[model samples]
Target: MAVTIFLLIVAAGAILFIYQTFLRDKWIRQKPFPAQHEAILSCNLPIYPALGEDQQHRLKQLILLFLTRKQFYGCAGLEITDEIRITIAGQACLLLLNKGWQTYPKLLSVLVYPSAFRAERDQMQDNGTVAIARHDLLGESWSNGKVILSWDDVEKGVSDFGDGHNVVLHEFAHQLDGLSGSTNGAPPLRSNSYQSWARVFTENFEDLRHRSQRGLATVMDQYGTTNPAEFFAVATEAFFEQPWQLQKARPELFAELQAYYRLDPREWQRSTEND
Candidate 1:
């Protein structure tokens, strides 16, 4: 057992060396966001416009880290340009804007598709039926250094930010949740907040599930009711996009999210409106 463990560690070190020395440069190249990207910074991304000066700078630094650390791969004959990568990275990093940029320390790769991609999902039924099904996915996050997204949907997400649907934010939110060893809605919390986070999340999740089942209007997407993980991601979208609506419709859930994300979009919106 000791010999086997030693060999495994040696193999892991060799793989890391090869990846850093050869495979990484051949696959992805990192570059700073140049001045030209600034036009789209204000054009396609209206969310950044509402942020305060400090927040905007912090978000930019976060984007730079994502660009440098994460590998961007293009699928379906697509070319992964700096523009596409930065735009996607910027939006994904927006989720961490209030939470500190270092929140995404585990992410390493970002795979981008030209459009909606398909994946095989395992489905089990109560009647003893089990099947593998194909799912059309916009984005996905993995604990082991991978996040996948559809580039077209990413553009659409930025274009339609106010509509409360952003695949990038949704998937990155899953990445945060994955930090706790599982993507069951709760991420790694400070020592004092874990129990309360779980309790509030569970209660609100049930409430949202009930509301969804009853056909009631909800501030968060009904897709959230699919699972606790989805609930967190979908709620994140609504929190950033339609903060006032979320606060008015589900004040408790909104408060929980506000505490988690550490930024109040309602305040940003009010300041933007006044300006």
Candidate 2:
């Protein structure tokens, strides 16, 4: 009897774990999103107001699941609050909307600092030796299930929602880029998309790099010239924040992103502008 009971308990535990792992996300989506959270998004997340009702519904579900799953911590004596969590998650969820992928499946945590923070970097020296240096940063994404951000920068990114330079979007783009392994400007793609994505991104990256070297102005950030990975992230920043400009300036690049993201930011912007 004792052995039978023990076996039963283990089986029950296993079943519970399986349910939580598989069924919980669908369960979360079936529920209504909180109104208070919507208020927070409206006030703190500027992009939320621009999203269409259906997109907003999809994003709200993503945000709710994200808040429940990912942990958030405060650094530099900062305090973590629901408002901060909601705002940050809302911004990050913009990338996940209209996709069936689990909410940042690889991400386990978010770390927020009160302001710009310094981190160490390793640089290759002339003789191939490594030199360590420290640099101040507003945001960073780790392939190991972590993202770090400055609260000040987060606030700035949302406040100027039209600037096409959002740190949250930028770093989260890295998170998505790293999903397929090394973030070499290519994330996992649907069938037959790799060729086009690679071609368009390569041309745009090279164009941006040349223009940046010549100190010419462009719709996409000059910082995108840093590398293929940086180009993808910075271009993602522009993709959502200034879609109209990007669509006008680089229609092919915009189309690739529109297809990948499965949503049109131009429509959102147009709706907002018409209002």
Candidate 3:
């Protein structure tokens, strides 16, 4: 009886330890972020003014989420300021405004560099050998819960959102796509919508590939023609940048993206412009 009582005490202690640890971590993550961080707003994008009062408040909340939940560090002594944090988090949360942003689960860390970063990739040999090569990247995403980006490109991406090239959106889109256990362009989809997404995306992807092969000037980015996965990322950049153009050029593809992202920036632009 004494042994059993001692065992229960041990179990209770273990449970309490775990609970305290979890609570501590959660409390730390919920800490409110400061309003002014030098880096966060350093490179403000022109599009920021278009956000309404409520949207602005939501953006502020997201900045705190990013600061508390993600790990960010500066390279070469580049200090991360509140503005930079807010800027990146605002754009990332833009995609989630109309939908459940939390759908992008499993992502845990974001690493920022002062500029383009270098990484090594291992090449496979025909005889089951591996060769390593160094490569430079503006941004990269890993399935193991990490994202790397260049600060220069991050600012450029925000400013050039209308141009359909954003590193943050591109990488985060990959994260969302990989949630279903693969990095292919196809992420988890509602059962009823998969058929349409597959059909429209495949048809458009193939068409883009064919046009690029023929050296035809395509509406979507030529980089998207590289692969279905890339096509999705590239298209996402374009969708956020030039929504009307995408809608006009590829209505079906635009519709799929609209359904997926749930917020139509084109409409936002129209409403804002009219005001």
Candidate 4:
């Protein structure tokens, strides 16, 4: 009798999990995306118009899923609104449109501030004494189920997507990098392609660092020179924002990103240019 009860409890738990995940996802799919939200996406995210119909549909679906799963919190007296949620969701989902993940599974909450916020951290001084240091951050991604962003920077990044300085893209790319268990520059690759990704990214990372050391102005962001993980994030920003410049300057790096993302921003941009 006890064994049968245990089995029933396990089955019930499994059923509930399925209902929360897959069944609710199906139910959400049937619901019409709000026209107001559509207007927000159309206005805030310029790339939305460039997306093909199927991609646009998929993007909206992904944004819906993201909004459903993740909790958004406003800090610094900022009120969380549909515009803020939809705008952020639109850009974040843009990265996942072709990728397997619809929502950032590891992420549970998004904390937004009105503007760049000061963060404090413990740092070891040269004398072996730990000191508290404060630095202003526009956006940051954490491995512990949270992403923090400045609303001001988010709007800036979304409005000028071609600037190649999107905080959303940069931080979300870190989330993708973390999906593989390592927050290193590399994310999951399809069918043993990590070798090529590693080679191409390593070479480009080194080149960027070298160029930055000489104070050279390059299409790649100088901030990427900080580390490999940062390099990958900035590369993702450039890949989507200035695809033409990135492709022209570093075809191999662009190709790796194109293969991993399974989309060609260059083609999208070309069509948009003609339009």
Best by lDDT: 4
User: Can you give the lDDT of residue 83 in candidate 1?
Assistant: 75
**Whole-model Cα lDDT per candidate?**
0.83, 0.90, 0.76, 0.92
Best to worst by TM-score, what's the order? Answer: 4, 2, 1, 3
Could you say which candidate leads in TM-score?
4
What does candidate 3's lDDT look like per residue over 1-275, in tens digits? 99999999999999999899668655654665464642344346445556666665555555555556677666666787765666666667676666643625576777788998889899998898999978889988789888778889988887666777888888888887888799889988878999999899999999998999999877788989888889898888888878898899899999999988776778667755877
- RMSD (Cα, Å) for all candidates, in order, is 5.6, 3.7, 4.6, 2.0
lDDT of 3: 0.76
lDDT of 2 by residue, 1-275 (tens): 99999999999999999888778778888788778888999998776777778788888888889988999999999999988898899999999898774787789999999999999999999999999989999999998999999999999998899899889999999998998888889998997999999999999999998888898889998989889999999999999999999999899999999999888888888878888
Clashes of each: 0, 0, 10, 0
Question: Which ten-residue region of model 1 has the weakest summed lDDT?
Answer: 24-33
Candidate 2 lands at a TM-score of 0.91
- TM for every model, in the order presented, reads 0.84, 0.91, 0.81, 0.94
Q: Which pairs of residues collide in candidate 1? A: none
For model 2, where is the 10-residue window of minimal lDDT? Answer: 45-54
* Tens-digit lDDT string for candidate 1 (92-149): 8787887754637788888889999999988997888998989999989888888999
- lDDT tens string, model 4, 196-241? 9989999999999888889887898999989889999999999999
